[model samples]
Target: MSTVPPLLDGPQADVQVLQALRTTWSDPPGWLGSLRAIDHKTIARRFIVATFVFFLLGGILALAMRLQLARPGLRLVSPEFYNQLFTMHGTTMMFLFAVPVMQAVAMYLVPLMIGARSVAFPRMNAFAFWVFVMGGAFLYAGFALGSGPNTGWFSYVPLASSDYAPGKGVDIWAQMITFTELSALLVAIVLITTIFKMRAPGMTLGRMPLFVWATLVTQFMVLFAMPSVMLGSTALILDRLVGTHFYNPARGGDVLLWQHLFWFFGHPEVYLIFIPPLGFISTIISTFARRPVFGYRAMVLSLVATAFLAFGLWVHHMFATNLPEVGKAFFTAASLAIAVPSAVQIFCWIATLWTGRLVFRTPLYFVLAFFVILVAGGMTGLMLASVSLDLQVHDTYFVVAHLHYVLLGGAVFPLFGAIYYWFPKFTGRMLDETLGRWHFWLFFIGFNVAFFPMHLLGLHGMPRRVWSYSAGLGWDGMNMLATVGALAIAASVMVFLVNLAMALLSGRRAPGDPWGAGTLEWSAACPPPPHNFDTLPVIHGREPRWMQQALPSHVAGLAADAREVLVTSALAARPESRPLFPKPSVWPFLGALATTMLFIGSVYTPWAVVWGALPVTVALIGWFWPGRRETEQALALEQSP
Candidate 1:
């Protein structure tokens, strides 16, 4: 059996082991690594591409809806088909795109920013990505097979029950929710563990970057919020397939219970999606503004405070459903109260930009736009928080406009900026400036043009989800204008695609620290190595790159020839232990395949669950039944801890 290698030490030894380090940490030669590699960078890249591909698919569905709605009396699609388009578009973007994309980006950047060799559970991270892909595939496959969900992404009950909705479609929708939410939960656990136990020595909670703090809070939100929806979906599947009464009102299950469970997750879901971008905005503002962000402690407290209050306000979505006055009052208070933390964060970013030496890159332009867009969205949100006003425009185009403004403006714009800022470090190429500016202007203008008119249409009594409308309703003009803007948004995406293509193929090669940022990620080589850093950094401040002169260059004595990371105390970040991480294996992929079968098979027949469990059990055995070598290494590591 193989034995643990001696741990390497000393600054000179760190230099000497660079080549050995790369070799030791490199993926196995050929398909063994190519197909089953557990390296965070490789897995993160794949996760990112996969999520964006889903984003593109979601965008196509939206464009089709826009086309059908472009002019009154357009029969480009039937009402039935329109239902499919609307439902799948929201599902693809929410479950498949927005949430996953943020996790994907974080999965790539988190480890490097925290100065860890890999995520806390690299194997679990791979498994999470696979499960996410399979879940998305399961969803789209049903759509292709004419069994796609048409009951809306929310899939409210009575309508979603087997009585009203008889088909494989709702069954597929219920199952897919369980699938994607499981993937989300696993990833959240991976990120939380990494942030808590794997930070570099001397990087205390106070010294952590705002991005890292944001990631931590978001994951915690996921852990708490996701299970509510998962439980709701599971109960839904049981109700549909087994005749349970979890959501059936006549037999004692309340229809409003579904709303409660769903919105509990739903409202927090918006913040979880929105919060990460707050971190992205802060990082970009600090980088382009050339200063540490203003009010570090306040920013951290604001993030935590926002998370706590998000749960209390979910009942506001149920205001028109005849909730008690006291309950409505409490929820309304909650919805407005959450805005305080958000405004504080906004002010901090503005102050950072106002006082510092500013650089106006594509990322900064996007950040600047974020302020205007989110503030507008927030005002509408306050309006919606009022029970009296919301009763007027409930389920109208105004709600649609408000949502996109919050999601697209609050999340997507910043994501684009993040891409521009981090692209060089990721791909070792600078995205062309002129093309980026063109892409931004088109996207910004297109977004406003497409969404702004919807607010007026809503006020004019344009209820959403209508396949077509009469031409004389005074809505045609705005509808046409919105369609034109949709095309512009499409064109902007095309420009971004072109820019990305040109940069990857033949753009200017970037140097390490091309932006001269203070974060630890820029301290590494451009595009970073498979092993990340050759030596583990000893952090002395929030921006390790800026404090490099005062710090000890490297932390020594971790094993160089094994997949290992320092286990630090959660609060103080003092070194506690270095444990050997598992190597690349195909079992994660195999395990995902097994789980997918169980989920899909359960949709058609109940016995499939029992049959499916067999292979799933086998896959689990192959995955966690460690060999003699791993057992020996674990024993050795534990001996001295």
Candidate 2:
């Protein structure tokens, strides 16, 4: 039988081991080591920053479009340019910013929250972030070259093909879909493995943190949903470049085929953007309200139920496409059925606030805003669920208003709360409360003023994506009102930026548990050490920090010399084994760079796809190559810590 050495035997041994771990796990000195770093924190920060940059770019596009539409006949931009602007704006926001940002937040927080030292596959995590960054850059490059896709965010066929849409623009958009889908798929698998295998001992499936549970469910959704778009976009690129007629009606292809594939992926994409925010709301409410989340099991079931029902309602998006009436009725019912889970979540939040002491901080304020806005969005969703109503307002600004409400209210508002709630944990500094309040009110009022008018304009027969309209159409006043609101929204974002910048530079230091929170993440040092815990924590109950129970004994057999973490059973999170970690390497980044060449080059010729695989294969081989000898040497030569 094998016996492992004690990682912590006595007080002195604990100090020696912790000091050694700090030296071993911390980022190596100098720029070269920084470049080679594979730490999850480093990569998560990169993902967040990169996704924010895309958000800024996409927001600029929105403002430009809003400006042109501020008046009845403004010619600030031509129709073609405006088309490109909206398409790029929608595509960037949904694909490049919203979904990726949520995943980035998960990447940064999941390990810390779950009491894991690092993500399951740190190198793979880094690789996914880099791929997503490169893909966003490539798509924007097409915009810079005056070749951004004009077909739409969904890129409906024939209009997206070379015959109607010549040039490398649509091809660029299609290939970027493949890049992002691959990135999403990779991150989902790694995160799922991490959550299942790396939770602290005694953090059973039921005991898993709510955000971790939300992330687990979302990743599962990603695993099942991403392939449809990946396959669709691949076929689109192939048809455009090589004359394979996957979407061509002349070649016996159905026009509706693109709709089927895209919506199948697209509908779930909304929930993928949404489900985590539900977790964020639950966490923030529970934290500030001084209570455990009400209806924890019901919330988990609602998340899972929402994910399942999300797939069934994709057909509702095609209500105006002339599908059978029976099919339309089924989709309509499914779409409306989704409202039940959402209402359950919101009412649970209200119920929590009803019974507990409430702290109305910036985060909680945003959560409150989410409740009001999500309900408004959901009501419109119910309206649109009817086949007849969708036909009337299918392509109008009403649809636009509904989506923004759902997304901004449902996801972005909660995300703001999440950022506020976790800012201290990540940055080791508290954001200014006064400034946070200003940011919240400005954003909240501005968001309503901007979108609420769009509903009126949509009802008044204002179609979406049009550069300008006739002054006689009643849309002029509402459009002008929206423009004013848009400016307010932009100003609010500026306020947030200023507040964030000030806090990072000069904010007050935060305690490990600034809000007296209950989760494991708050148990670590503010901006936690490289080796998260000096000795791994033993979790006893759900609210580890709040229970006031005697702390459980730390695990003793882990090696202090090498990077070692315990792997646990999936359900009970019982200790199963220890796994050695891979050293920092540049291969993941190199592989992503090589893979990017394939995506970008394919826009020129299909031959690039075959050629691109060679470098990628080489990079993968090197990435997975073992360092068994060096690892053993490091472990054997180590003194007793």
**lDDT string, candidate 1, 114-199, tens digits:** 88888988888888888889999999999999998898999999899998888889899888998889999999999999999998
Q: Return the number of clashes found in candidate 1.
A: 0
Given candidate 2, what's the lDDT at residue 249? 84
TM-score of each: 0.97, 0.97
Model 2: per-residue Cα lDDT over 420-513, one tens digit each: 9999988898988998898898889989989999998888888887888988888888888898888888888888889889989999999878
Top candidate, metric lDDT: 1
* CA deviation > 4 Å runs, candidate 1: 1-16, 29-32, 633-641
RMSD of candidate 1 to the truth, in angstroms, is 2.2
Q: Model 1: how far is 175 from its true place, Å?
A: 1.0
- C-alpha local distance difference test of each model: 0.89, 0.87
Q: Ten residues in a row with the worst lDDT in model 2?
A: 1-10
